[model samples]
Target chain A: MSTRSLYVSADTPVHRLTARSKIGLATALSIAAFVFTTPIAVGIVLAVAFGALAWAGGLRNLRRVWFIVVALFVVGFVVWPAFTPARGPTVLATPLGSLSSYELRFALGRSFRIVSFIIIGLAFVSATSNEGIVRGLRSIGLPYAFCFAVGTALRLFPTFLSAADTVRQAQEARGLDLSAGNPIERVRGYVPLLVPVFVNAVRQVNDQSMALEARGFDTRGERTFHGKRPLAGRDWIALALATLIVVGTLVGRYGFGVGAL
Target chain B: MREVFTMWRDTRMILLVAVVAAVYAAILLPFKVFTILPGLTSVRPANAFPVVFGLMFGPAAAWGSAIGNLIADIFGGTFGPGSLGGFVGNFFFGFVGYKLWGNLGPLSSGEEPNMRSIRQVVEYVLIAVASSAMCAVIIAWVADLLGLVPFSVLAPIIMVNNTLAAAVLGPPLLYLTYPRIKDIGFLYPELLADEELSAAGASRRYVAAYGLLVVSLVWLGVGLLVGTGAAPGTLTVGLVGLVGFVLVLAFAIIGAERLSAILERAGARPAGRNR
Candidate 1:
């Protein structure tokens, strides 16, 4: 099975940064966007995210989500402010009554916030591998078990995708017309397909468990790993910058009321 | 808690979690419902994973659901900050289901569901409803606070979608797999009950589940009435409903226990088997 997910590897500074620092920076920037919803705050986050995207060579992957982002952006620009009650002093052209400049700005800010989030996410996933995710999460003080579970899930995703495809093909061969129904009917058509797939997956759980145990998976207490990359000064700098973004957003919003939209 | 942590770390359990997450994400990613809102919420039979996997693998399933939702977000083209919310909320989606069933009635010993008892069936539905509400409340609260969507719009949709999947489809699936997994000696939560439940804790969980059911029903009513223009004040009603929902979930999750003893004492069942 192909190990194809959202991940794309490129040789760049952001990509060279450990997964832990990338995750930290992206997560903090995303959270800061949420915490401070003003245009200035969101713009700052968006700029950083775009910088990361450029550095990580994630811009190429933007094609995959362009349609979705554009659709959401249009909706946010047009519909959200029309529905939102809050308004500013200046009035933008309201084809319908009572749309204001503030609502438009706010809506624009929101769209930017979402776009920045998506960019940061794409950058992180593009730079990091399944192993990187497990190690990074473990480094950040998550339980080792949780980290393993995350890594395992990433690794198994392609296998399950293939299995689902095989099940769909088999059902199609059996004359299950999953393609020829109305929307609701089409969804209902999936019931038969899903039931068999799920049952098969459930059945394999026991054997899989047995296999793991036989391979010394049950061995506990003080385990050693092969690829343990300790954090370097560069990683610490990234962490500090991420932490500063979060802390600065909070203090600015509450202390000085600088960026509270 | 220590024993449960060990279960998650066990290699076999980790594999089980991985497979569960992967399958669920794969099934849901392609068919996602792209809303005007910018996150991954889909018309999912994949919702079945948390219910089934939770029963089969315990805490491992909770971790799986969390990671699976993240993976689904990435695949569905909506991975973002909201996914942090998605991860936590989806974890409870499985955790609540597992915790609710693991110690309830005949399942207290972690035996396979025989489907012989009406009370157990009702309990499953109650658990489904409460868990759905729990997920909807937590996620919508964060989303609304961050100005994604109003609580009224997001909560009802999620609550209805999840409950319909779990209630309509979960039991038959659970029944079908129970015997097979038991035969294979992989029916999880096999450990005898370790936590000593005080009566108060048990009653609180019962009350909480029941309260959540009623409050959610009323919240749904308010949503319907408002949608049809029969009622005004949606935001007010929605905010109120959200508060009530969160309070009840606290009771359900934090003070959790089996409701079998209470139901039997209330004369719902004439005979209590194997007490």
Candidate 2:
């Protein structure tokens, strides 16, 4: 578990921006990343995105997602070419095989496209807390209750795994050997292991609801903030840069097309 | 503010469990176990995850499982309205278990499950297995009838697949609820502390000591009945799953009905007391 999911964070300028803005930035960049078939454009965009992420989330955290990045890249650049093979003009050659210009382009385009998606996703998850996200929604005049549920779901994700781990440990100590045996025997092992995890989960929620009810969670009153979460000057700069890059690239791709480029 | 933060953190732990289930359901099943099951082809953890979600988080959990499965299908390129049917079917699969616990009010006359009565244990297993089996079969059958999924490709697989999921995952999920429910706050107090682990729960522990006996009896029985293609074997496995589902439901119902009776006679009895 690299634990570098979209949820990890640092209170940098990028982190302080609105979650919706971050989401929009990623979505827009991903669309542009999809447009440019030239590896040169993708290479530039990836470099810029990587720099932004390193500044926002720390290079170390970005490095943690290398396996995921590599895996997806492999799926895009290698696995897909193998499956579909090249059908268009010749572009890249290898001793083992050669890629048609179109196949090579598709794979290269996809790799960069998805890379942008992942980087932006990582940025948003890293920067935003579910509370701030929910409050941000409320600030936009969205219903608070629905935002609360979504926020709660986001917050509880990690805790659920810990409980599941606890159940796995309990079964393992009892010599249940969940990891052993053939595939069928192994899957069968989960019944005993996961059942308990589910049990604990249900029980935990009931307790949580009771605790929340005690604390007047549902009372119709103005909510208060506990921690400092603020928008800073640098956050706006990152947003502006992301916007410029996205708009410029899209305009370049659409207006010029490949021949003009 | 600190108290509110701490409480939110605590609740996050519970949601984390759902996330774990979602991730495990997505990642683990695809790689080896789901893929390499020799006789079985394309047995998805996606459908059963909804069941597991229902068991864990009441009805609300099913929504996440459903959405998660839908998302996984989209990425995996297996999405269709047919799968959407499967999602709904899977929701009912969990509803079977949650329905048991939520049969009465939220809580009142919950009864503890004990294996002292073998007959009751048998009955419990049957209902749990049967409930989900019935749900799976009906959904597949209706979908086929309604032309949601083709009968040629999906109908048989759906029944066997759903039943396999229910039979395999449902029982243990139902059974494991006993020990953890107290800490989870599903019960009014510690239900399992006074009561010994049920025959099903303790069955794994005793397997070593009674290794031969269990192997000869249970495994041999599995071989004979399943090998011989007896309906009874299928029925037995199916029902056994419900054993826990039935027990949990029994407790939930009993607790709901008997809340006043029990609460009226509460901690007045003092500590170190058995219910």
Candidate 3:
């Protein structure tokens, strides 16, 4: 029932950058993770991502979700190699198959890549608010209506979650045993819970739409914002750095064959 | 295709998008504990929301599902590179059901969107499965391309998860809500201008689109089996599958655009709101 978002309020250089720049940096780091297939290259990207997270003061956020990070890392490091075909020198013989050093390196690199993505995503979300996301996307030239919908959706998430919990409680009070069923039965049990929630939502749409239209929601022409801030010099520097990282990784991976597993 | 963008113009449709996004994400958040693959996917009973909402609200649900899944990932601690794929995949997960529901056999003769009859139920299940498979392919393919996961491993998992949720929960929810929503004059077709709902070239163009979809899915399915069975960890097969997927998806997009253009040319008039 916690309504808090991942954004941690702080005054840091990473937090000072605009959401658009953070988004760009995250994208660049993600692409770098995907492009680089060598353990060393992936490790470097992971390091940079972690460094960004630390700079954003969001390292605690990473600690909060450490279980998932560790689980994914384990899956990638231990389980993924089993799916990969053994190649190069054989490291060990097991009942399933012979383990290869090449597969181990591939697994390690993949794990690092996934971890780097997580860190970059954490850094971005930790520094960006829901309004910031909408504003940043608008600044990046997405249509106003789409951005408005996204912002509204984010704002409504907590409200809907609270409503759903209330409904679940009311249903349970009415003898709806949600936990005492098999998987299919449990899924079917959701019908009672979902029907009322959805019906109520549908009913609200009329009122909500009327209210929106009353506020000149359908008005056309250029709109002005109350607190719009143009991207500063630091924003451009962040953008340039993100572009450099992506282009550098791309060139290193394909152009020079530097990161091939 | 036009409705996808045009829905943003209608206040009701835009509100529906927000409601769907909020509802879907809210339901999805609690289910994060049932993780089948950490940071990738889970046993998502919330998957049913997209199909049901899609059938009721049309293209708004498509956008909603995409945004909703992204929201879930962002809050649920699973957001990552693969989430880009999840966004697009969940859009089709909601989209294909509504698109095919009214266009496919038995239901293609301009039937109202309902789950009243056995034949209609069959069609619904078929659409759910199709949407589920399409969603799976898009996500698994992207994951494979990104080297995050193998296609052969992830596709079936997502397919089963989505189809099971949609098939189990879709009918009763749709049966209960469709009539009420329609009565309230909130059905997508009721809210939009008739030009937005124009059916010109729909049947033929959809046939082409669905035909290509089936073929591409089959191609990907075979590639999945080969990639997993014959040669695990091979890039060539995955690349070939990607090419076929992209080619077929491009044709499907073209077919949809042609349908939209034809509808625009036919100059369908608005069916004024009954309310």
Candidate 4:
């Protein structure tokens, strides 16, 4: 059930970097992406990142998680205008109708910014396991409770997704037409599904807590994690390169004006 | 001795609650087909489950429901202005439910909520109304505090809409769903009685659910009373802020037994049976 097209390309240099460095590199890229809202700058960074993904895995990873990026982009570009009081930079002109140039351009740039981060997130998931991230967080002195919650959430995502599927199917077998109903009818249809899903979630949490206790989860005031992935030299170098890419963009934005990007 | 409440011997109940929680997450998710609320809308019905769970299970259930809400938000596409607003709003939403149900009882497995009594129903209404008012006030204050949006913009509409939505939606949802809660594993009567021998290491989440409800409600009351900077919300004034939380505590405790009946159907609770 945990199986899927892995976001992390196998045996790649970026994939091999210590998760700590990767997270740092990813954060730097995100900062650069956020700052350089200029279309040209965003386009170039997106292209470079996409190229890296192609080289590491294939066009496949990009295709698989592209939906998330697109969703974020649309929300920032389209939904924000309607909801927020402040209007975005205008960018277009329509002689006959209501569309304008300024608002359009600003939306496009915002879209680019969000999509760029999604790619960064993809880099995170594709390169490291959830355990790696958890250990990295704990080692870096994040609260045990917080880190544990994250780890459990990630670890259980696949399981929960699968459990959901199982229950959905079981309900369907009992005359539940999951796909064909009005929104209200469908919500009511979900009654059968909710019972089992929550029962399982509660059961799992209880099980997980017990499992942790048995493994001495709360035995000592401090806890140590194993399976620490070491930072190979190649991994560090890739990380440095990633950092430089972002730093260059930021420096260009604030120091040299938008043109530097 | 109290820790023994966690065992799950009844396979069906455990299976049911887990499945219910998962499905509950799916349904509340904004992208989920059944989303009744529109894009960026805060009112949601699926909240009753976690509220019930927290009241039944304790603080963890509160956290779980909160997480579930966040999950739904992210999957629906991370709404930028939404991140903090949604988190706090939903947190209090579930928190109020937990506070109502969790602490009012002695917060132990054997102790029941007197569900058969209409007094419990009154308690539920009081808890629901008080919690709703508190939530509405905090959401408005916090929204202003963050400067993400202005009170001038949001308060006029939200103040009225939220109060009505919470009071109306919260009680019916609880009433309809509360009856089914006993079906969950840890609360199974058969297993609790037969497996009392394994009670030593059992988890007290079930008990804590009730106890923590009382404690958390007090926190909510204190927050509401102080944050409003006035008195109980009315017409245009909305929630008025108070200085000390004494009134808030009084509201929670005085209404404590009258509201937040976590121990309903005490004999029906399946405390030590959780495997």
TM-score of every candidate: 0.81, 0.54, 0.90, 0.61
- Model 3, B1-275: lDDT tens digits are 56676667788889888889989998887743245776545666688888788877888899999999888877765678888889988887777665665455444433454677877677777778777888888887787777877777778888888888899989888888877886787767667775555343766656755765575467557767765676455545467667766755564454432312222343431333232
Looking at model 4 chain A, which ten-residue stretch has the lowest summed lDDT?
A79-88
True contacts kept of each: 0.42, 0.15, 0.60, 0.05
Off by over 4 Å in 2: A4-11, A16-21, A82-88, A91-98, A129-143, A219-246, A258-261, B1-47, B54-59, B66-275
Highest-scoring model, DockQ: 3
What's the best-to-worst order under DockQ? 3, 1, 4, 2
Candidate 4's residue-wise lDDT over A27-146, tens digit each?
666666667755677776667656655555635555654555565566566633333333444444457434344445555665676566556555555666657776767766766664
Q: Could you report the DockQ of all the candidates, in the order they appear?
A: 0.42, 0.08, 0.57, 0.10
Per-chain TM-score of candidate 1, chain B: 0.69
Q: Per-candidate TM-score, first chain only?
A: 0.87, 0.77, 0.91, 0.79
Candidate achieving higher lDDT, 1 or 3: 3
Better of 1 and 4 by TM-score: 1
The model with the greatest lDDT is: 3
lDDT of 1: 0.65
The Cα local distance difference test for each model comes to 0.65, 0.46, 0.76, 0.48
Q: Ten-residue segment with the worst summed lDDT in candidate 1 chain A?
A: A1-10
lDDT of 2 by residue, A1-261 (tens): 232134445777666676655654655565555556666776666776676677676455456556556665555576345434457788878798888876776666656655665565455445655565566556556544435644554455445556666766787898887557864576677776566555444545555766776876652456675664464555466567668867777778787674122
Q: In each prediction, how many residue pairs overlap at the backbone (N, C-alpha, C within less than 3 A)? A: 0, 27, 0, 69
